[model samples]
Target: MFEKSYDVAVCGGGIAGAAAAIASARQGKKTVFIEKTVMSGGLATTGLIYIYLPLCDGYGTQVLFGIAEELLLASLKYGPGNIPNWRIGKNAEEAKRYRIIFSPASFTLAIDELLVNAGVDIWYDTLICGAQVENGRLTAVEVENKSGRGRINAKCFVDATGDADVAHFAGLDCPTAQNALAFWVLEHAKGAKWRLEGSIESVSMHADGGSIDKKRGMSGIDGAEVTKFILDGRAKYLARLKKEYASGNQSRTTLFPLTLPSMAQFRTTRHIPALYKLRDGEDWKHFDDSIGMTADWRKSGFVWEIPYRSMVPVGLKNLVAAGRCTAAEEDAWEVTRVIPTAALTGEAAGTAAALCADKGISPDELPVTVLQDALRKAGNKIHLEDVGLAPKK
Candidate 1:
């Protein structure tokens, strides 16, 4: 097998993996980012999931900062969106929980640019087929690509594969969940301009179509099931297009699909069992190892501090989970699995990875205080007390 080494290896090129790689490389680590798809911005771009969720606590303050905020604004750099000028109080109400709608294509370009400028060695079109762990420490990841089976060795690794692919491959005990079947496609409306659908509409689809209830235990872990899910979603969308054509809806005819999501938009698949699992109603709870803070996107005043323990897998020593695959119960999963949370956790995991590599220690052994200090200096609000936010009334 082909072999290479890096200071930090980040699996998956979604927002989390991208953020993690950028963070590590910016800290002067030799970082490598691997993604199965050819393009960057996994779900946000390839999946046509256009919403960049909020970066603030919903009441009247901005909570998440650092890479989370940087990526949110970068998403708008080449697309249509708004970011209120909090300094001058211009559209300050909108700044309370700043969110934006960005073009998937533009986001892909932006993320690629960020990675290149960060000096990250990105390997696109690579899939992590297996992983190697010796004495509870991740040593290398086995990947398959045009080069065939290869090994990527790193001092520290970040499992940002969204489904915890690296953790699962390393024979770790991980929790798995199935997602409801949902598909999103980008279509061009000749005369229509893009608009933000507000908090509620951002998550809902206004397209004319029906859904196929998920089959029992049809998690995407199986290749056959994944194939079926994609084909079924595509067929449904095609049928809608045909129906519109037959109805003589001239406007609908101009609305051609811009691109289909290259990856299935499954919200959750597998997650590592970490030292701590963020649970429901734990909002506003303080963690001594809190690395960053995130707010519940669906509602108004609940805030959660992400513990460093949650990113540290239970049995792994040199690896950390940075995406939705992070440890969280069903309800808390909704909060941590979004775009903003992915970037926040990714930055933490990458930063921690770099520190661990630099100091020659495992992620769990690295002092949380040191990591927190670095994050705070990087513009992150690490605690509820710092943000002055609390559970909703």
Candidate 2:
């Protein structure tokens, strides 16, 4: 019904886009965030990817803080005695595992409040179909809603559209790699007649609850059992889910079938050629631009630097990318797919876009130091020790 623009535009009202919009609005820039679905939290809400994932490094430091920390702490408050841990990493010297978990509904409300309080404009159930470009830079983007099609012009744009929808439409070469895939999920529950004692399992899915079926869906089966299974059996279930995904049929309403998100979720689609791409190499064993980090189940450890270049596409002066759509190898999707890391990058991208507006410069030439400081001031973690960019020992 309304057709207007702002200083900055971020597509994809998911965690990343929301963080970027909030960061920009907080800095006094008029910003707009767009989402194809309602209930702004993206994967966290609509997709049901409840776990925020990889919030900190191994040193017990939250490499990705700022709005990321704010959202998690707020969500964790609902769980009385059983909140997921937020401490990962040992110190600033080495990368550690991430310890972050959040509820879907809690995450949605928390960030929705952040955006509202900060005064970032957001549109839901909208899809960006194209972009309005000048000689090279994008001047405005074309979007479509249920009513009709329209346009939004902005000083700069952050393509947080997850699948790089905006950037690709703007003539940016967004190559969809075949290495990964994505899906949205909805989980239902059924028979709650399962128990785990002190031996192999200490938690019980059926202990104090009814069954996890339509018969028992109405019973007071909170999210505790889901968290327990994810934390303790992520590796196990991950494999099982992958193996049985095609054949695993129990009713989406059944407890066993309702195990994952409303539908299964996917973040990346394999190799993308941004100005920078996270290559599969050992030199990155210890990254230099490490802004945030994540560890995979205390096994093969990885801490990634949120690179300034990743946010800004190389050739597109006005366009930037964020969230699971950013540059990453297929295998690395697990790390960046998390909400906090994605939101941190979203924060960075938003900051960069606003910087372009303030300095009247291209996103490529926007002051990195200034953007870094703004992000740092906003409470995002940037690894200073890894400044040398050395391989890990």
Candidate 3:
């Protein structure tokens, strides 16, 4: 039985996993990142999602910050800015800011460089099959790779598997829903020819393939980014209709100008559930333990601070969830799963895990307020005061 160990072992090599591994290692933990695939940057990098959706909370607020944001910029820096408007075609300005949205291959390289520079021991092409728990502690994680089945042990473990695979296998309390749409990461091999009749931006979304949702709501948004604006706007409209007890019958919607690069891009799904959802109702009104903030197309269009408790799993002691699976109801889950928030949450989870390891304490026992304070001290913005939560258009 091939056996290896680390001070902290991070499962999943996606953005969250990468961020967590780097954060823990940066903080002086002997960290190892285990990824099932040869390439890193699971979704954003491997998935080839160039633009960072809702990086800023509604109202132009930057809710999540730190290494995650750094990586987002690093990835997006290769491309042009998000369309000028959060809504498709609407933000002609954003489309102009960035140039040549980068390929997923480039992103993989960037993430690899970042993690390697941070001194993380990354194991590629390795699949984690299960966990070995003893005395309420995870001694090692079972994995299978080209070499065969073996075990990788660690003092502290962070599950960046957006699906919360480790937590679920370890029998931890997690949110579950049957009909959640799987996020399909399609290859954008075919160059796009977006259809734009009259739009401020020069490009429009292609009617054929590509999954990036546009924000334009009025209709006729042929651009990926612009259309996501439409979809978000449409979702908002539906939510408003549902709120007013009115029928949500939409006859049609149009596409907006495409984002930069004249290429197809899409990533997202719906109906995903959460273990500990953070609703804007009484639960959130009285939430004292804030971890981060998020925004989506809903009544609460503004971003709200996420409580640290939300990040901490219900039963897991050494592990923490860092991506869309972190903890929020269906509605909130949709928004939090966005690239930037996922990355940021991963960063927080990783940072918190590293802090716990440094203090020789359990993640649940670590002082959350202290961790939040550290996030801010490290030039990571953590307040709604300076960074407003407005529509990022």
For model 2, the superposed segments whose C-alpha errors exceed 4 Å read 77-98, 179-264, 270-272, 281-301, 384-393
Question: Which candidate tops lDDT?
Answer: 1
RMSD of 1: 3.9
Cα shift from native, residue 31, model 1 (Å): 0.6
Query: Which clashing pairs does model 1 show?
Result: none
lDDT values, one for every candidate: 0.83, 0.62, 0.60
Candidate 2 displacement at residue 283 in angstroms: 7.7
TM-score of each: 0.90, 0.74, 0.71
Superposed model 3: Cα runs more than 4 Å off: 77-102, 179-276, 280-287, 297-301, 386-393
lDDT of 1 by residue, 239-265 (tens): 877776787763454756757778987
**Candidate 1 wrongly placed segments (more than 4 Å):** 84-96, 190-217, 250-252, 390-393
lDDT of 2 by residue, 1-393 (tens): 346778999988887898889888988999988887777777677666655455544445444567777766665554312233335334422222444334566567777778899998878878888888888888888888987887888998988877787877777666554311232232232333332112123222321111111121111112453344334334544444455445654332243333344322334432224766664442235444444443332233345665666666766668777787888664565566567767777888888888888777877787677776787677665653433323463
Clashes of 3: 48
Local accuracy of candidate 3 as per-residue lDDT tens digits, 1-393: 699978888998888798888888888888999998787887665544544555443333345567756776576444333333433322223233212243455567778888999999989989888988786766788999988999998877888776677876676655543321112222221223432223234233232223222332222213354455434534543443354344333211222222222211223321112325665332223244565555442322455566667677665567777775677665555566666677777777788888887887767888878887877766576645436422231
Using TM-score as the measure, the top candidate is 1
